[model samples]
Target: MTDDQTLADTTPPAAHESPAGGVFGDPTAAPLQPPTVRRQWSIADILAEARVPERYARVCLRADLEADHERILTELRTLIDVEGNIIEAEDASLGEETNTARAHRLNDELEQIKADMAKATWWPRFRGMTSDEFAVFNKEHYPKKDGASLEDYNNQLVAATMHEPQVTPDEVAALRKKLGMKAMSNLIVKATEVNTQGGVDVPKSPSSLQNLTRQ
Candidate 1:
């Protein structure tokens, strides 16, 4: 045989070619994609993801009732000295009957004050919403009247935010009646603060940290 013909006869086929002359690999096959990377969350990221921010406030429905309670406590202290001894007048002018009557009256007043106090104090808890939720809430509830002043809009917003408490309308109404406008407004302020600020102690920013560490 001729040298060129002999070489051609002995030559191996291309790696990608089949014995029957068809291509061994599919050229139309999709290219291999990079592997997906699993995200590694930091402690702060995990905390933020899991956290449901909340704020709490103690509201005094009746300041006068608290003052009355303190006053009664003082009077009781005077009637019975620090050592638990009853003090008597020099002339016994204030007789046993008078002292007993005074003691009974003070006890009754103190009992009444305690009863009033049970209804006078409230610990209202407020929860902050996610940004998406707050955006939707603002869109749905924010005042958009043509003639509404800034103060009117703010008041409406605060009221809407405070009403987020999961109570019935009747319960809210009763609380409002007892709290008066001033106390109710204060609650609204607290609610707004929590909702907007997240009511959490945030880690200091890098700039603030640098400032704190400066000599």
Candidate 2:
């Protein structure tokens, strides 16, 4: 069909063509065959030979077996990636739901604690109460009606009575007497002494005395 094929068919043989033998060799001699022509394949031919329908074919069929294998693997990988995305989304949603449930439970506990604290008269000043104000408040622990629950009241009482800043009745009496005194310096001194005995001592200043006297 091609030019070489025509030449192969018609070319005359030279006596010195080959060192091995003439074109007509001994009866058992191997004749020279024409050079092989490389075949060009179409997509249809490639698919027919590939045979992916019935079962997984081995690499021997395709010319570029490695390249073809990578393509197949890439498709499989894409499918796997899609499934993984769906699974990850579900896991994230479940985690968020769990966190929300936990948050609600903690909130309920906090509200219960607040309700309990509401029943006491003078609650611990931890959140907002200052040492100076608490010193004035002393250990006055009582139940309040606003948000105080009975349990909160009981806890407050236990906390208040246990290890309270000891205030002697004598000291209160002395402070009352000192507060009634007309001299500001004397009143300040007495308040200081009362605080010292109560465990959280405050320094008495003459400036405070001057202010009180002016008032």
Q: Once model 2 is optimally superposed onto the true structure by TM-score, how far is the C-alpha of residue 102 displaced, in angstroms?
A: 0.7
Residue 103 in candidate 1 has what lDDT? 66
lDDT of 2 by residue, 1-73 (tens): 1111121122223633333333323334564464598678799987576411111101121223335445544
The parts of candidate 2 lying over 4 Å away from their true place are: 1-97, 123-215
- Which residues of candidate 1, in runs, are more than 4 Å off? 1-40, 43-48, 60-67, 70-88, 94-108, 120-123, 131-154, 163-178, 196-215
List of clashing residue pairs for candidate 1: none
RMSD (CA, angstroms), candidate 1? 32.3
For each candidate in turn, give its C-alpha RMSD to the true structure in angstroms.
32.3, 50.1
Please, what are the lDDT tens digits per residue for candidate 1 over residues 62-181?
A: 777877888888887777777876665555563355554676789899998888877767777766666777788777655576443333333444444553356543454455556555
Q: Give the Cα lDDT of each candidate.
A: 0.58, 0.34
Candidate with top TM-score is 1
